[model samples]
Target: MENPPPKLQVKVTADASGSEKTVHSSGLSVRSLLKFSVSATLGGKDLTPEELGELLSNGDGLIRFKGEWVRVDARKVRDLMDRWTQAARMMSSLGIPLVQGLRMLVNGPSGQLVQIPEPDEDCVMEPGQNLRQTLDILAGKVPVSIPELPSRLDALMRPYQKEGFSFLYRITEQGFGACLADDMGLGKTLQAIAWLDTLRRKGRLEGLPALIVAPASLLSNWKEEAQRFAPELILRIMHPSSPDPWQPEKNLRRKDCHAVITTYGMAARTSALADLHFPAIILDEAQAIKNAGSARSRAIRSLHGERRIALSGTPVENNLNELWSLMEFLNPGLLGSRKSFESFTRSLERGYAPLRRLVRPFILRRMKTDPALVPDLPDKTEIPAYCSLTPEQAALYQTQIDMLHAVLDEPDPAARLMLILPILARLKQICNHPAQFQGTDDYAPERSGKFRRLQELCVSIAARQEKTILFTQFRSIIPHLHDLLSGVFGRSGLTLHGGTPIPERQNIVTAFQKESGPPFCILSLKAAGTGLTLTQASHVIHVDRWWNPAVENQATDRAYRIGQHRNVLVHRLICRGTIEDRIDAMLKDKRRMADDLFSGGPEQWLMNMSAEELNNLFFGSPC
Candidate 1:
């Protein structure tokens, strides 16, 4: 009798959309096709093309065909059985032993043994048997392969790794929330780019739809850093120049683009693009939305996305309430209520574990302690120096204090408010020296112990070929310090203040940090404290102190941040027998009070301190 002819077979499966069908040219083996079809039908809801492929390969379930539901059976396909029988014949004809071919038989496409129905010393084989059948039979014998896990890097990442970057990646992979709390000068931008790169490498990123909301000033910086670190990642700056700010469709559709960098201003006006459903959203200088009730914050909250990352150096700048707003953005309920956060902060201050539990899972903070990843650091030592007021400054300060007292004694509230401006002006002048306002030729006839010490310190740093940064609250006094330093160190002194245009400010900072240029840059504390980098200055002098410790730390980071190779020495010049000392003490006490209030406890200072205590700090006593 003649052997049966090979049967023609066809297999069909649903496409990703499930609305259309795809027919494979060579029909799938019974076992494999059943698994693929079943998985497709069951896991078909809202599945992406890639996800559907994975589901079909791993799933095991019954499939319905032509209104008949059939459970997957290993022996169902006749073609698979015939293929295995043919494989056994080919092995035998090749002069292979029966036991050897039986060992090689393994399993067929249906996951069944490749058994030779009949064996004879001389059995004629059919001409239709082919090598394709043999391969399909062998495939069923192998076990399902397991995939490898992602490799984890053990070495510490850069200390300034932006928390926003890490948080985005963690939330996407682990479905958790996170916050990026870093001091200024730490490369938060770079960390964000790194996370994007990781996603790209894993093929998890598609359409590269990422949005970076930053300050208008830092938009260029973001563009520059993205170019430097992630050159391949396309960046489109979303400004008003585009045809339609409201419609980001043009920028969003670009093949090469990965991220859209926009300012907080633009994001507020054009929130319609939020529907694009970005894979990741990063808010740089996140404090820009510290006010939860602001339109900007509301705009950001309106955005829809799976991942949200907030970057800010001053996480709790003015109050712990600021942290609540930030956390609410990152994860709706991670930090709980404002009341609960207050409680948590109280617990944290008392070294309680609850604070860690609440924050650790979502917050990853790296300070300067990690040795492997931290950048070259400069030493920051606070030096206390006293300065005697010039006769003119002394006279002016005394007059102003007396006037302030007289105004305060008045029953009129408006008069008291008016007195504040003049007192502020006098305090400003004192920070510089009365000569700054009085006259150029005027001098502090009374020698200042702090001035003498500062001079000595300046000379020593100059001699050692090191640079210095002198900070004062008053911009008016920058010129005086420039003059005084110039007389001592010649043209090697420069001054930077708010009046300095943005372009010129950056230029001056760059010049001061140069190895062969000016050895000192005197800056108005508020102007140059937060964003500028001045690593060449191995020495930092705070001629006047600010009430906020975070502000002070920001200024310190200019030198202590990345690229400093030498130890940094910081000097806080205070008039020893003056209100400066008392003010410094009061500021420290206030910081402690703020810390206590947030750490899940009551603020004792708020209750205990009367109007008298507040008034005395600003007026009554000299240090």
Candidate 2:
């Protein structure tokens, strides 16, 4: 009576091409069962339409099909049943694009993607588009397309650069946004210009001018590159201080300019840009809008554009949110909203693979290490410039560590995390110099061993008359480092931090790049780490270590990028017998252990380390 104990197993399998969605139960395939069940109901025999529905509703149930009872669980069959119904609905209504429908079906109830098979004709992509080709593109398999750069491009593109241009070409043709995330100095700007030129050649630029937004520091670079590569295209730079910001608007209205270049800050601050429509909007160093809640991101969403492209080397420096933000800007709502993405990600134990699949088609990334991209790039060697803390620094560092230990002992684990963050901040500051934490602004070189080592290195560096980038994570230490570097290099140096005005950042970078310019450029890690092309600097010095090695590597890449022919040296300053040394080792271990699938930042994991581990990290000093 209870429908013989369910023993039947329902196996659902997608064919290799994903064209067929087959369900098999009791040795009967979906196609065969489709007819067998229908005939039984039509003949008024053992099963009815309602009986079939009832069978599907109960996980453990018996179904009488042609005199034999089949045992099965409805739980396993419901997903396919539901999908079958939905697919029929979609087919009868407006058909869905094969790629889009496949993407949706694969991301199941819990965001886990099922195997992809050949799509149904109703789900096939637009006429002439191949699903396999699209998959190849998403997976970054360059499928032997004749590599071509823009005919009008004044500069010669490398073979890999040409390949990059083609990827842009194909994606834009398919009506999708792109993220050209080539490593620092792999010619992303040039590739973009080439793509724009192709659009012009194809007459896609007739409706409206494309918009290019970058950091205020790179506005000049964009202008200069435009002038150099696409001389035929009229490019206008829109800025707040320009004598006539309206000129760009007038140009757009009359369609005079091929492209309008503006800074993210100006685009957010200037009301006029908010309403402007363009055929394409390209964001350079787009990580500037990595925070979804930032005004720049909101401003970007408001602008109307048919196509979006984001260029950044370090797209997701801290967490997956950064990648989500970049992808959202490039293709709004394609990955769902920020809240939806967060919820979906939190539901999975490790969502990196799913996250990659969801955004792969939209973002095309190439790294400099690919010999095909940068064959001639000189090798870079990173040396640990170890220093013993001056007695003053050592004393303050000890005191700070003791204070953090007290904070870590708080009753509330959450409260302890709150306390630990600031404590870590203070510890790093004390390592830099006692003066930084003491609020005395006394960054006397001799008071800190790291500072003393920096002086010794800079003296030798200055003798070579080569440029260097001095990077520190803390803004408060900039003045101190600048003063010391100025005396050592015997000339003024440029300093950049988060507080630096957007309009003036370009000027500082340009001044630092000139042959007669400052010998050193002091920059905070977060502000100047990613977008900068300070190839003039042959040496990169890390005044203090960030918790993440990728971040440190990004900062170093500001100098060790494509342009420099000279052998580059990277110096990471670490206090020999302190928390910095222990952390440096721990970071290396963690990176090796995680092998890049690691999602959370180092600080979060550090907080979870056992108290015994913490004691070992803080109490013992390694030289």
Candidate 3:
């Protein structure tokens, strides 16, 4: 048998003016009408049939070939026709055949399929030739295959499987602004790191120039956690000794680091460093930029970046305006002017739009209770300890309260304000002992029912299989509590306070959390309340009360935050009949006031309550 005839290949060219040439297989037949019309479309009305034949014969030179003003590559057209015919044959073999002549199919791979137009149907199939190529060109194309992401991303994101993670992923992917509003110790850092790691895996991260603007105190902690969680990532701490701020690009390039952790102070003063463009910039403890017009805020705003993320547990710390500042940084013009933002916030409190749209896409917040992955936390048990003051301490407390009430009644507002610090100091001293602040060296027995009750609770916590943190407003009381617990339980207790030095604080807390030996830690309310993670202790004792609920909550968070497997028990010890009860009542009202004011809601009665009303709580006696 004879071999099948070789398929034909042709090259078509359009000249600078307008032209074409056609080459065909020697055995193929050409119709006279097809040849005449093809030449007419190419040369316009000027060329005759004989001239067109001559032009086709001289295929080596550039000729004017036309099908509108579009330039079609002949090689591309021929290749497309071959692919179309192959695809059609494959489809037919699969029991699906394309109908010819402008037919459409809804279930086709490209969603809809249309047949190629014929030459005589007023559609010009120029020098390139063929209905298959025309059809292939008309079909919309599919994108190239997307490579699979790294398998490690699943392991990395395993820690953040909460609904909040979806919100975070969307924010980073869509460049939407977001605030992670989770309470302290709810794993905000983990969520952020996971997001960054995803970006790295997806090849979206570039230059490896990410800046984590955090508090000076948290700089090292961030570095350690980043290293622990993302071992593959390289980190450089940007400090005064690191390198010249003017040359961040050069220094970062030299080290080939993926991230840099720095404090707000360093980021603000280092103007030269702000010039380098980073692909990803994250601000940890973003509340540091609460003042929109501050130097730190301006410096961060000046820093160039393709993506920006802000992380803060307290995004609306003292004002709603602070939230606007953060939104403005993430997406300018989204929130409009400060004045407009304030107006929008008013309506937003009433559930209005545009304002909600401006904020909803940018902020992803979750509470500790929101994470379904984590088991239910231990219920916070507030064991109110009723303690009676020693006779001397009781006398001193009465004397102080009386004087404070007198001062509060003074005509001058400044005089009344001046009395606050001293009154608070005296009250705190009385809770522990008169000697704690006054240095009187007078010994006082713990006679208050609240004090006796706390001692019993401490004994119970010490006997249990768990650990406990006892918080007191008076640092002087830490040693006393430690001594009391030591006398009762013996070497099973430790004390932590402000003077313990920054480096040793973490060490002490770690030891307490590990529960290798010690069963209790006595902590000053101010010092151990924030920043430190003490997830080992299941029980927290508030030996004294604070005026700010957030402050007390921060203290509770030390033990209750991430990693605790048991339910956290919180004890708020308040004296039954003293200034402590009065103050606690006042604080509840103050917290409501602060929340309403900061949330851009209408002011509460607490904000307008007179100093006389406050004085009445302390001195006028409950009816």
Candidate 4:
């Protein structure tokens, strides 16, 4: 009779000879001393290494060992043994790093899924005192307390913000990099600043100043926030365009400099920024380095820092590759090389849960909707305000569609492809208003359906005397929106686009927050999507779809964050029976996918579509 299939198990123990060692020479740097042994089990007992050797030599698919009959596939047996043998050699000699140990703890030591009825149940780890204590601390079972905020920290931290500070402090204290991915407007900046202050108070940052890399637009915002919250922390802005043009190497050497802030572009181009070592390197809007192979990402990785912190509302903006990039920047080799990670991602047998489990320890994500944080925040209601297209808009949109068809029929594919984005932009512009597409000053309320809807909404907002913020991707449309909103509210509102000087952006934000400030503010979506808090406004309107849920959500959070006393109403305007409507439908599915995978979708997918598919997608009957 045929015997039952073999049962595989992994046993892990702490080896003292290799106890918590570090090897900086070759391969992955070693840290923990966890030894791994793989064996086959039958009924209740394990087969010894000698018995497994005997089984390997056996010709039959069945083997009798330890006084019990067991069946095994010769190939699986050899593969398992070969994998564990290599792991044993590494663990016994140099020891495994904490990341490798964690990976092994989640996945088997072979770094592959073991064919077992239950992998978690079959594997066991017997940790030594040090490993056990570290595991307990990471698991949060053993309380590790961080120091209370010193009086120098001017602002009162919310309960969750304090928890965020502790998490950053604790994770970095253990020599692991951290990703603080709290929801936008939940105070990720404040938490990072608090941790830096704690390090300063403890004399951990005595000589080595911390480095903060942010977007150019947010450099001023960071300066303001650091000054307001942690006034004692001496800071310097290191950019050529700063009021005091920073002489990179010279300014950084000043003894009073506790932290240096620079833009990602400046950081990549300036060699002096990369030359010095920093105690802590914090990246705000960390998604800037999502492309692992980009020059910016390479430059950021080249900088040496004892502790790394990546702060972003949306860490995984595009795909798992982006997540790998962030992880590689935070902790090199934590997820292996980029090529190997790509292989793992493509392998359906390996699964993604192991990857998630491997990184869960290092990333701290807190949503605004969490039960713990909900009480401290006010309510937010998202309302979809649908609009119809005018006859003029329909004609303009159809003209662009026809133009795209003409481009599609071109003999040269590259030339045809080059026109896709411009054509798509025109199509979106037509959906906004015919005046916007025509480049005319005429934006009559009746020329566009969206304008009519905007008029109605603004009239209601003005009647209630409530303020609203308008966000759009196109800078040219800001003037048009300002004119329309000003006429409705009977007062001139404010505008912030890419052209707004960096110094003035903060001044505009500050002015808008006051009780008697402008009743409305129109902003370019990209420039003000992040790093600004406008909780004073009770309403937020998305003038057009960026087609990216992560970005649109960040824009809406500008008002829905910590300080607002009243409930917020978010208006997402959709133009019916157009590209806007179709993308709006796809947006829901994209959001659902992002929620499941922590990734995002880009419009590049549209460029790959066939002309027929494009026509059907955009010009087809809209639901």
Best by TM-score: 4
- TM-score (C-alpha, index-matched) for candidate 3: 0.65
**Model 4 off-target regions past 4 Å?**
1-101, 108-133, 151-155, 245-247, 349-351, 406-418, 588-604, 607-613
* Per-residue lDDT value at 10 in model 3: 23
- Models 1 onward score TM values of 0.62, 0.78, 0.65, 0.85
- Candidate 3 per-residue lDDT, tens place, 294-356, comes to 887978877865567888767775566887788767765455567756764665544445444
CA RMSD for every model? 20.5, 8.8, 19.7, 4.8
Kindly provide the TM-score of model 4 when superposed on the true structure, using C-alpha atoms: 0.85
lDDT of 2 by residue, 1-623 (tens): 55443343222222222233322111111121110000112122234447657666555656664466766556644444455445444444333334334334345113222322223311221211234444455456745343345555535877777777777766654456688888887889988988887776666687678888887667767777878888877677787655555354466554567788887877888777667667888988887888778877888767776667888877876666777788667665556657767776776685557666667767777887887678889889888888888888878887878787676567665666677778788888888888888889777888988889999999999998988898898898898898999999888899999888766787888888788888999999888887678888889999897766667777888887777788789988888878789877766567663334323455655556666655676776542
Number of backbone-clashing residue pairs for each candidate, in the order shown: 9, 9, 22, 0
Q: Tens digit of lDDT per residue, candidate 1, span 1-623?
A: 95432221212111111121222112221111110111112211333445334433433345443353333322322333355345444543233221122212221011112443322111211211222232222222222222221233113344335334534454434333356665565666677777766655555456646788876545556766677676766666787643433248555656666778887888888856666787678888777777777888878877865566777777766666676687777766445555655664664544645444344445555666455556455455766666666665567667766665655564544555555656655664564555655656453423434455677767777777778888888775666567667766756588877676544565686577778978888888776676567888888898766645666777888788777888888888776535676656655556665454422211223233344653685566642
Candidate 3: what lDDT? 0.58
Ranked candidates (TM-score, high to low): 4, 2, 3, 1
Best model per lDDT: 4
lDDT for 251 in candidate 2 is 65
